[model samples]
Target: MTTLAIALGALVLYLIAYNTYGKWLGQKVFRLNKDHIAPSIELEDGNDYVPTKKGIVFGHHFTSIAGTGPIVGPALAVMWGWLPALLWVLFGSVFIGAVHDFGALVVSMRNQGKTVGDIAGNVITPRVRVLFLLILLIALSLVLAIFGLVIAVVFRLFPQSITPCLLQIPLAIVIGFFVHRKGFNILIPSVLSLGIMYLSVVFGNLGFLADSNATLAAWPVMTWVTLLLAYSFVASVLPVWVLLQPRDYINSLQLISTLALVVVGLVVASLFGGAPIDGLRPPLEIVAPAIEQNVTAKQLPLIFPFLFVTIACGAVSGFHCLVSSGTSSKQLKCETDARFVGYGSMLTEGFLAVLVILACVAGLGLGLNKGDEFLTGTAAWNAQYSDWASSKGLAAKINAFVTGSSNFLQSIGISATFAKALMGVFVASFAATTLDSACRLQRYVVQELAGCFIDFKHRKLAEPLKTEKSFQARKTSWLTNKHVCTITACLIAWWMASLPAIPGASGIFGQPGSGGVILWPLFGATNQLLGGLAFLVILFWMRRKNMPIWFISLPTFFMLILPAWAMLYQIFVAAIGSDQSWIEQGRWLLVGIGSATIILEIWMIVEALISWKNLQKTAIQQD
Candidate 1:
């Protein structure tokens, strides 16, 4: 029952926070006015900036920000114990993550739906804008490269999940067509699509479909990465309603339903034990230690900075800010919808993280098998979580989540096969959403960068000459074209993913997604820094508008300081200060790139400080 209380308490707290804190931020703080024309309405680009309903916008925003970050981050962080992870997800999501996301959305929406990185120049400094966009380039490339492989790996791990996930594309396209082109009501198509989606899940593992899934799963990882990136390239270039929005919208529905099922399952398992293990039902309880009583060098250390970085998406992730500004901000038809699409989405993700914690620590306690012997309770939890180093890989982390979640579903009379397939599809589909969304976001970043380059080349040209009909001018213009920029994003990611993840291990053919794995070390800190940088933009924007800066300032510093602090620790304490540094491990690439990102972050911060000082002087002069 403690498990039930924890889950219920977290859910209730989110609702209260949404109505109280979230509402206040939208109304009193941000002053989201519905009458203020939105960028989607103002810009009215039928492709990227289509004005969208709040409901569809909410769906797209939630699923895109989610990805596997909440799942993977919380799953890994639990190595420190369930309690720390739970507290962070509960408080962090409400105060930090949701605020970060909400602020980014409103700021971007007010900035004519430009990405925060692009708006950084107007608010902070041009140099900071360039710095921030460079950071976005690296960060998004990491996501695009990593997520394609993540979905591919998910397909391999749970073959039955493949068909349902693949089927969502056409289903979404159909829904998009009827709703947008034909002027059909969205309600009917949505309900019908969801039913068809669940039916796919139901028969996903049966008959020839199962055989097809297995065959697809057996294909090489490189093949899937190639196809997935190609798909992302096309999705990125397409209009918003054609693929990205509708697909993500429908994906969100399935995810919400799965979450509903997990909650119901949790309630059932709380009252009575989960499905029988070897003809004996085992009571579902928190099996993992409240705190890891022992620590090893290879295991995670529960400390101020470590826990914060380890559990990013569940609590606060910089990546969320990009999603806020990049895609959702463009689609929002009204400024009033920012709170629901931004703050509410983070809270929902927080609840999902809570469920993941329960699934790992409690639901795993219900049952698991090892070779010929079946393990229940603590032993089952320990099997996967015995030593952090043992189950630290992507597959291991996902398996732990899937096994535990499937156990939860089983408690509610769900068949074991279907339950696992549902959870598997849930994870894979979410990752796929992130993949496509990142591709689109990356395209925006590239276009911005390209536009800057074009301006530089034409800086000295006369007004009329700037719009030259010459071949050179035409070639430069192509740089900003949506199709070209999207292709650039996908091609860069594909090229990077094709490289060996580990140096001197093999050529591109040896290991899949090697390039991203090599750069994986930088993702956590860099991503968090982005949130801080975004907060800085929001703070400056509010300051310039003469709005209250007190509220936005604290989170800005908190986000800015922590990620840098973590980077310093990893560099000075964990790496250089240690007996066996990264130098000893021969990871020169990590050392070099990580150090570069930190320098870039510091440079941007210094620029911000200068900008703030000038603002203060201007205020004094006005006074």
Candidate 2:
């Protein structure tokens, strides 16, 4: 009953926010006029800028942003108890995440579909633009490395998921051909593709082609990582409608079905299966005994800063800004569609995060079946999340989500093996989508950076000759050659992932070896700081237009300070104070990255402030 209540309550609140606050921002704030020429029409070239229907664009946008961030963040944060995670995911999504996503999308659309990093030059300063691009490059490099390892880990741990995940690629390509090239109705084929993928899931669990003796079953984690990155290379370079859109569309259906399954299973478990509803409350209390006993005094950070950063995508994420400005902005057919594609998809992700909380809490309460061990909710959760200091904590959190969600599925009469397999497939698919999207976005960032440098060199050389067109043509040729940028981006990610794991950090997954776990500590702080910077960009844009700035201002301030505070604490108190050698090395690198990001953010904010004041004065003089 409590699970049902939270799920339904979140849905209701999101709907209200969408209709009221989201509507006002769209109509009054951004003034999204449909007549405004969108980039899809203005820049169409049968490739990235192809005009897409709102439904298709929404599917692409939602699945790309709704990746493992929502799943992993909430799954781990619930260790602090459900109440805090729940409130933040709810209010933060409505007030902060959606607003950031919507504002980034609308602003990018109005600026000829340029990325926020690119637009930073016009709004702030050109030097700030280079700095912003560097931040994106670093952040996305981490995203690619982490998501690649995440999917590989899922495949290695849950072999039953391997077949279905691999099979989706070809199926998506076929669907893309029929729907886009042959002009077939997308609905029927998309549903059919989803049905086929689920059938593969069942066969996958049956060891149909995934037998223990099969080639894939015996592959090392590195082998899997290599294959996944190779696939991402192809997926990232292909036309959007070919593989990216159709695959995400199919995955979105899988995501929705998984969410529905969890909701229904929760209702049945609470009402009919004798699960307790007392843990589902509004206030912060130590509901889980394992968290109380095992999660010691210093194991976790304070709820204020850590909670906000930890529960990133569910509440707010800087990565969402990249998706909004980088990809979705290029494909929007109508300016008005920003409200639905940008705002609506984020609310949907928030609901998914709510289900992740319920799956970890109420679903755990239903009793987890972990091989030979039959543990209650508290025991299962405690076993995994008890030690944040261990390398296994990441694997534990992921397992908790899988085991608890499987328990929910069991209440509906599904077999436990198949249930686990389904959850594994869902998670792996989400990670795969994010992995490819990050690679593609990284390609864009690299090209943008290349263009910036070329322009500077051209300015120097052409100062005497006044020959700008030659440099302009050279720049166009370089940027249009997408393969060079894409390859460079993929190789950097591969190198990062292939780096040997930190010595002495071994855990259940053994040596981390390119697994994102080594860099996971920096993810929250870096990601949230990116969000704050994105909000700062949006805030400055609105001020320049003389629109309401309060909506963007509040979130901007909160996101900036909290993440910066957390990063500083991590650098001074956590890393430098630690005695472990590997801890010092690995953590200090993250500190350096975080410190550079902070410096860049503060510099950009100051520039934006000065520009805002000067622009206001100019307006007054004109009047």
Over the stretch 1-623, how does candidate 1's per-residue lDDT look in tens digits? Answer: 99999999999999999999999999988899999999999999799889999999999999999999999888878888899899999999999999999999999999999999989988888778889999899899989888777887789889999999999999888889888889898889889988989999998778999899999997876788889999998888889999999999999999999999999999999998899767766778899888886766435543578778778897999999889999999999989999999999999999999999999999888877667877888888778787766766788789888989999999999999899899999999999999999999999999888766665666564553223443355355888888889899989998888876755665332576546666776688888888898889889999999988787778889989988887777765564113444655677777787788889999999999999999999999999
Worst 10-residue stretch by lDDT in candidate 1? Answer: 462-471
- Model 1: which residue pairs collide? 501-514
Off by over 4 Å in 1: 460-476, 503-510, 575-579
**Candidate 1 TM-score, C-alpha based:** 0.95
* RMSD per model, one decimal: 2.8, 3.9
Top TM-score prediction, candidate number? 1
What number of clashing residue pairs does each candidate have, in the order they appear? 1, 0
What are the lDDT scores of the predictions, listed in order? Answer: 0.86, 0.79
